[model samples]
Structures are given as structure tokens and as C-alpha cells.
Target: LHSYTKYNTWDTILSWINSIASSNPSLVSKQVIGNTFEGRPMTLLKLGKSSGTTKPSIFLDCGIHAREWISPAFCQWFVKEALETYGSDSQMTSLLDQMDVYVLPVINIDGYEYSHTTNRMWRKTRSKLSGSSCLGADPNRNFDAGWCTVGASSNPCSETFCGSTPESEIEVKHVADFIRKNKSSIKAYLTIHSYSQLLLFPYSYSYNLAADHSELMSVAQGASAALTSLYGTRYTSGPGASTIYLAAGGSDDWAYDLGVKYSYTFELRDTGYHGFLLPESQIKPTCEETMLAVKYIAAHVVFSQ
Candidate 1:
């Protein structure tokens, strides 16, 4: 049986990715985009059946904040669902037939491990910058979108520390660079986080409207509706700054600013009942509903493109 029933550590997650790719040779392949600050290989598992041609793609990642363990678990669950349901489910089959999904299972590998081992709430990269005793920059706040401005903090010790520079975090840099390189074919970007139950789109850095503001709002609405259809779980979807608090430098904003028109950040599950320590028992339901929303977005990207 698939082992996503429980929360997994870094090694277990990596091993699962490897196992999935190896077992699904016809449909899945692996890419090592870069190494983390702690020398862990950051892996991207690309899922699609080969058709002897390049296809439009979607970029998805989770655990950029490290402590949001459920975020990364959703990535794993997504891959598992894609692999297992591809041949049987018409929607997944068609989505995979038309596009490739690039998944980075865990962006903040070092801090994710640290969260499990040392601090259960560590939410930054395990990097040591000059002139600071504090270890780790909030990788989510280290992106180049709005940078350190607004809800992000300049203090290194703050939980929301924006790194010294945009792209300062190696993991963020690698992910950003890869998306930039693949910008032409990347149709959508989805970054998963937790405890807010919101599906947010671009212009997160500012209250100003994105070019496709109305369309993104419409898609998010449909996607949110789809999520609610399963388990009746309610999720509010809108532009990040207005729906959620203004947290600049989020990956969703960075990806949106980079021209991925369908960019979104999924704040998965709970209104803070479990907080960062969401129980493992909730993983399956969370992933189930999240899969619905993801497919809803992926469908929009596929058919609407």
C-alpha cells in the first residue's frame, strides 16, 4: 500500500519519489534540479506519458517553508494519484496526455529535516549568512516578487525573514532559475503551504490587479467549488494580498510575475485547529480534496490553453 497515510521524513519522502519514478518508467522521470544548503539533492519528478514531443507544463512545489509538512505531503499524494489514476481516470489521463507536471517534493529539505529532528516549527532554509547567528532564511519570503517589503521581515531571527537578497536562498534560486529556463512552456505554477484553507493567485506582492485578474478569480472559484464538492471542505480563493495577509516574496507571486499566467498558492487544510502540527490522520482527506482543486486548476490550464 502507498505509505502517505503518515507524515514522512525527508529521507522517506526522497525514497518514495525514487521508488515511484523507477516503478512507473513509462509515465514518470526524475530530475535533480539542484542541491540544498545541507547538500541534499533537490528532486523534481516529472509525470507524463511520452508522446515524442514537448508539451506545455505546470510547475508545482511544496515545503518551501519547511515546517508546513502537509504541503510537501500533498505533492507526494498528487504524484501518487497521478500515477495510479492515469490510465483509469479520464481527467488525469487527459491532463497528463496534454501537459507535464514538474514536482519538487520538498524545497526546504534541510529545514524540513531540522523541523522533524530539532525544532518542530522551523520555517526557514538551513543557511548561515554573514553577521547573523540565526540560521535559515524564510525561503518563501526570499523570492524576488515583492522581496523583503511588506509582511516579510528583514531581521534574520524573525520567522518570516526575507533573505539578504532576492534569490538568496539556494533552494529558491534553483527553483526560480529552473522556472525561468522553462518559462516558455510552463503554463501554470502552484506552490503549496498550510493552515489557511485558501487558494490564492498572483499579485500577492501588491493589491494592484494582475493582468488576468478576473480570469484567475474565475478559475479559482471553480477550483474551490470542486474542492468543496469533495468532503464539503470550504476554501476561499482569491488574490493573495486581499484574501490572505500580505506576505510578499511568495513563490506564487514570483512565478506569476515571471509570466506563468496560472500561478497559485494552495494553503491547505484547517483554520489552525492543528496548526503546523496537523495530525497524520487528516492527510488522506486533505490530499483528496486538494487533488480535486489541483485537477480543477490543471484542467483550466489544459483546455483553456
Candidate 2:
């Protein structure tokens, strides 16, 4: 029952994770993939049954946009729920028996902390660029897929600023490297964001449909329907560019490019009344509903194979 509104600080989040890992070493494994430009450690937690060699893996990431506190909270909640219900709940136990869940609670630690300490709306990594005073690069737009093309900004100060080069930000590089290393086992890649209520799939760089468009749309619709069943939260599902605003170089698209079959970007919770300021009370229900969607997708991934 972690509160996102109060625990938005990076230090507190990291400390909480440390405490969990310390107490439950057998269930939680922490891995530091890399360091942010501001020297904050970019950590990931791996959760699953202990005695499996080749379980299918799903990658879940949150807070890539910095101000999306609810996004990261959901990631943390997913980890806890998975660990708590592993052998007791039939669905969770079955999922864990077949798949390993990798959760990156906060992808943009520097920007997330900056949002807590200085600004309430920061959306990028706090990386200083030469010849400009504006800090940070949009980690979402820093991926290598269709780099600097449509739905991205070149100017350093823009909210959608693509970095000077693809994978320029250490955060983006680290995630890319981790995905690459686990490419064989990963079946789904989910990046959680806030304020839009969208379940978006690939080919975000253009209007052209993905080769697996029909199958992707089917899973997206199923996941969306599952969420709606829980809280009547309706989500528009389609290609990222068509469903929402198009943004080039997004992790979802990049993961698709890297051969992860089911890549999605989930824009969670309320649709802009609260916007980035999603309340703590909604965290539990949000995570619970989103978990239904996640399980729907995971079950599909398993059954299809």
C-alpha cells in the first residue's frame, strides 16, 4: 500500500525497494543496469518463481516521462502483488510459472526526482547539453526507432526533445542494452505513462500499419476490455500514432523493432482532470485494473505459443 503522492521522491522509492529486497531476498533480485547523467542508479527488479530455467519474460517500465508518479507506483505495486500472490493465486502462480516479470519502477530517476524537488511537471532526463542552458532529454523520444523523425522535437528545451543522437541518454542506452541481452526470452514490453487512458501498439513513427496489426489490435482490445470490466475505464486501442499523439523513438516501438512480439505503451488513470497529479487513493485501483489488462496480454502470449 505505497502512496504515490507522498512517496514520489526517488530516495524514498529506492529505500523502500532496498527494504523489500533486504527482507525478501529469495523473491526479489535487484540489478543496476546503468547510472543516469546525474549519477542516480537506474535499477530493475526481477520477480518470478525460483526454480525455472527458461520462463517467458515480460518487461514492464514506468516513469519514463518524469512527472508520471502514478506510472512508477503501479510498477512497484505490480512487483509486490506478484510476490505476495505467487503460489496462492492461481492466475499469478500460473503466470509466474510460465514467465518472469521484470519491473523497472522508475526509468527517469533524475527527472522524477527533479519533478519532486523543483518542478511538478518535468518530463525529461536532467542531462546538460553544451551551448544551451536547458537541461534534460525526453527519454521517451531518445530511443533509436525512427530517431528524430515525426512526433519528436530537435530543440533541447521542448517537452518532446529527442536527444542529439539516438540512445544519447544513458537511461535509454541502459534499457536498450538490457532488452537486447534478454531479447530471446522477452515476449512483451510494456511502458507505462499517465493521463491519457490509451493502450497503444507499434508503428508509432508512421501511419502505416504494423505487419501484425490485426493480432496486435486484438490483444489491445482484449486488454482494454479487461480493464473496463474492473472499473469501467475505457481505453482507445490502436497504433500509437493513431490512438494517441505520435511520438517517434518511443520504447514500445524500439522494443518491437528489437523483436519483442507484443510491445505496448499504457497511458494510465484519469483523462486529464487530474492530469499528471493523479491522487494516491487511485493508485490501488489503478494498479489492480491495469493488472487485469497485463494478465490478459500475458495469457495471450502464453497461449499463442
* Best of the candidates, TM-score: 1
**TM-scores of all predicted structures:** 0.98, 0.96
| Each candidate: RMSD | 1.1, 1.5
Those runs of model 2 whose alpha carbons end farther than 4 Å from true positions after fitting are: 1-6
Minimal lDDT window, size 10, model 1 = 1-10
TM-score of 2: 0.96
Highest lDDT scorer: 1
lDDT of 2 by residue, 96-128 (tens): 777778889999999999899999999999999
231-259 in candidate 1: lDDT tens per residue? Answer: 99899988888998788988988888888
The count of residue-pair clashes in candidate 2 stands at 0
